[model samples]
Target chain A: MSRVLSSKVALGGWIISSLALAAVVVLAWASPAWAGTTTPVLRLAAEVAPHDPGAVELLATLEQPREPVSSGRVSLGGVSVSFSVRVEEFSGAPLLALGTAKTDAAGIAMLTYRPTWTGRQAFVATATNEAGTSLGSATTTFIAKSSPQSFAGTVEAVRPDGAIGQAVAGVLLSIVALIWIVLLAVVVRVNLGLGPSRAAESSGLKS
Target chain B: MSKENPSIAEDHACDLGEEVTEPGELADVRASAMRPVLETPRWWWPAVLVLGAIVVLGIVAWVVQVADGLGVAGYNDRAFWSIYEADLVAFIGVSYGGAVVSAILRITKAAWRAPLTRIAEATALVTLPVGMLFIVPHLGSPWKIWELVWPPYWNLSSPILWDFFAVSTYLLATAVFFYLPLIPDLKIAQEWLDPNRPGLRSRACRRIYKALGGNWTGSAPQRRLLHGAIGLVAIMIIPMAVSVHSVLSFAFASSSRAGYLETIFPVYFVVAALYTGVALVVLSIAACRRLWHLEAFIHSRHFVRLGFVMVAFGAVYLYLTFTEYLIDGYSGTSGNAAWVHQVLLGRYWIPFWFYFVAAGVVPIVIMAFRRTRTARGAVVASGLVVFAMWVKRLVIVIPPATEPLVRSPLSAGGVLAGNWGTYHFTWVPISITVAATAAIPLLLLVLFRFVPILPIAEMEELAGPEERAESVAVPGLSSGDGFRPAAALGGRSLAASTSPPSAMGEEGGR
Candidate 1:
């Protein structure tokens, strides 16, 4: 009976140690220091104007993996050239898209983004190769608060401006329409000419 | 007054030399031209099967590429415009060559073009569709190709949209150009089809000929109307061909890249197309002469004439290349200098030098030497010109595209793999290109099986005075001042000689 109790005590001790080890691991993962240094992270920055709130600027930098408690900056240059990055609301509705921006030598991309809503937002950057194969992706979050501005200016800026641009567009379309019309006329004329029995019966050749 | 087999007709005419003036001889000439079309050769089936297989393989490869994206075809954003783009240009350029040469000959009233006109126009007809289809593979989303023609979605400023417009219109014009000339020949082919042999294939062939021919009764009014229409279309085709290659050049020249930012690119592209087009024509003539036993028709003199034209265009292209380089290279803008250096002295040196030597120098030498001005020599010269021009197009496209725009340092992976990256061709594109190469001969071989290899009507029109004497003697012929009524060289034909017995008897009755 004494030997059995001793064996039971040993089994209880093993269980207690395993539980303690798991708890320690969970604590380490949850800690800020461990979370910051454990994996490569994405750094996001927003440059917003107080008065002209529509012109919101978004910047994304892909950070490299690091050791815990280190304050040194990691090199992210050449990691993302012509990479796609997006700014969206926390609920996943996109507010701005910087379509395929040119990355600086230092691996930072300055994107021109106009935010629609004012609240917590997320920036997601995706890297891809020339073959359109995705390499890696990262995301970061930020908050946005802007002064009231009408959406009219944004709409105006999006459209082609000036009479010259409009005139060029008009002329090009007209030419295309004319070309199609002329081609159709040629077809109809050829088909009409090919009508049966148009040639003289005496010759027996109907050309 | 009796009809003789066409096989011996031409030989008898050539042997008799201005003596075979009987009306039955005309029927004989038509029969000779249609012999290859009517009689199937033992080798034809196997050839078709082989070419068909190659075409099928290419189709399968294209399907695979579409499903997996252009990445499966070795297309990266860095190498966005590569082999297929060059192929498109080359194929389209050759078609332009065929159309322009035939048109110019017709316009100039070069009578020797009789045997060649049909083949040249048919080349344009077959190739335009092939060239146009390359755009599908070139696009990232090929299924969205309808967006090009759909009016509302058209991008007015896009070079590609204009390319679509020019090519589609050009295709329509080419088809009409090809078809209008074919009407007379089709009528003649219908006459040759033996009603006794009522096989499915023969019946189908006869029906097609009649349908295409329409009501072409070789009467004076019909001939005049047809000639007028063809003349008008011929005048229009030249400008259309010019516009096609010019717009194609704009796609490159509009870009700010070093080699592409030249003012002379439009003319350069057009001249190159002309040079290569004429050379390909010479090559096609040689192939036809051997394959269809057209030695009696397309003689050594024809090759020499075509070679002269090819050489003329080659000379101009060489001059343009020099001028294009001298101005740009002298200015020494960093981009221009870098691109020029890359092509001339860097990685692309071999192809550049090959274009200069083979397309330029060798052809000039061949044309200069009287002994090497034979048909065989011309064929060799054309072969070199065609190959070298294709390489020249690659040199034109690749160097400007790959020249560094931003000059970022090398990375482990991504578009910025180096300070400037090169377009590396993989197996996928190579296979697809090979398949395209095989398609040309395959298409031509199959096309000629249905129609006479030579244009029967044009041949009769251009035949010697001896052969045309019988044709002119028919009743109700309204011969104008420019038109000859009979083989008589003088203003008026002798009344007795004008009434050939064969013209009044058997053929007139039919």
Candidate 2:
């Protein structure tokens, strides 16, 4: 009876240790796949090349890693990549959309940007698949030496010389001035009584 | 005339309870009108003291704000324009009542306007300055206010510059409108001063009255000149008031904000001003009637008629408000739609609903029924209208100012937005606003202490035989003898009472 019990206990311990080892092996094998599936970090790089006097060729490269089992394709293409620029260095400053382009067979997207401002410009590139799932994004900064034209600051006031505005203001101010003059005149006339009082005339006649 | 004979004066005093046989008599009109100026009521001192303390508190709050900065007043970058701006609009907006009652009614020669014009005009005269003073607190640095008017610092194209011009011009016009009809009344009051009184107060009153009255003897030429001047001013003031409020709306309308950039804003503001203006006039009339015991002159009919006018404007305002919301809401623009949604259903829902219920529904319900359209009812409605209008102004100002305009980069398809900022109410602004509100009655109370509450000359002038007969012939309404009560032509009275001579002459001379 003692020999039988010891054999049973040894069998049970062997089974438990084998099952735990197998589970560890499975989890170790699946962990990388799970991480890759959950967070698919794409390699995206944005490059700026000076084109015309005030224009630049914005190039975004969406690099995809090769699979161990190859699908026998030479290039990845047709992914929609968007380009944006932030001229201001402030974190709160908004990123203005430059434009969007599809990747070529070389896995590169290109856009011609005519910058209206010359400053420390930061460029951002984002890639998304056909299903609109974001693949990844990248940012690069460069000094824009020249602007297409004189950069008008964001703050704009109503110009006094705009034709319609000028005309309207003129008319309104004239009317205002006319009203003021008339009001003042009326007040002055009331103060002076305009003419002799009828009571004074009656008193004079009585005298 | 009563001063010539003590016995006759005593007889008039005794006949106070009985209806006077000659209501159109100048002496009787003068006596009734000048009662407030002559006598200081028991309640006056306490009311003044309380109101004055509040005004002092407001001034102290303002001083603290100036010392500490606008942050103490719950102002932030997101809520740059908030309570003080609304107060400015509301205070100025209520002043339009004076224009409506004094200018518009005078132009139309509305006979009932005679008794109410003084209160209306005086209200305008005081409240406009109070409203204009709001700009001081609003600017945060009032010392630089001169830059708004100074030519070198003037931004001609700025709506703020135009606002200052329009408001100052309107204030001038309001002053002229208030003073033009007061000449003959000044003369009447001057005549009432006792020659035997030996005091600086009496002498000062005489001199001031004489200076303001000029050489007016109620003669034909003086009346003609005065009438002509008043008519011109009345006509000019209407458009001036319209421009003032329109320009005021332009300050908001010109902004490229979701809720503010509406074409309907000018007309909307003008109508709101008229609506609130009439409501205030009704309230002032009710207060004067109750306090000074001028029920014989300002009957319940005045309240009802003014209530009707207020409701008419209220109806139009409601329509305009509906139209404003419907158009902006239907357009479905991201910003405007979001703002509208926020106002109707989001964070600002309480104030919006409060305004809708108090201003939009209750007043209409009150005015719709005859039983609820009494002096007390008008007072209730007017009070609600005034408070609700202030709330409406806040709704107009704050929501748009604090709306989130920037789009988040992480948003899918540019749909998701940032959080909307909030304007928290602080004690500083509340104190200042309450003070300004209290200042209205306080200033008016002080004003009436010098000038008659009623326009004595205008009332007597409008009290011709035909007018008096028409007034007297009205069913369920009667007054002291031949005196045509301001509301005689309007409708039936809810509460009417007359002041006897003894009450009128409680303290005849200062």
Best by TM-score: 2
Q: How well does candidate 2 score on lDDT at residue B341?
A: 95
Error of 2 at A123 (Å): 31
Writing each residue's lDDT as its tens digit, candidate 1 over B1-510 gives: 112323233322221112333443323434435666777768778877887887788788887776645655655434557778888888788888778999987776665576788788888778778888788777746778898667666666678888987888889888888878788778767766776777887887888887777766555555666677777778888988998999999999888888898899999999998899888888877776566555545555567778999999999999999999888889876678777887889889999999999999999899889878877778899999988998999899887776666432453221221234456665656667677767777788877867877766656554546435543443322243223322211111222221112111122213
Q: How accurate is chain B of model 1, given as a TM-score from 0 to 1?
A: 0.84
The TM-score measured for candidate 2 stands at: 0.71
- Interface RMSD, prediction 2: 10.0
C-alpha lDDT of all candidate models, in order: 0.68, 0.76
Report the poorest 10 consecutive residues by lDDT, candidate 1 chain B: B496-505
> Compared with the true structure, what per-residue lDDT tens digits does model 2 show for residues B132-241?
99999998778898987787677777788898989999999999988888887787677676767677767777888877877666655567788999998888888888
Q: How does chain B score by TM in each prediction?
A: 0.84, 0.87
Candidate 2 segments exceeding 4 Å error? A1-160, A194-199, A202-207, B1-27, B198-200, B409-413, B466-510
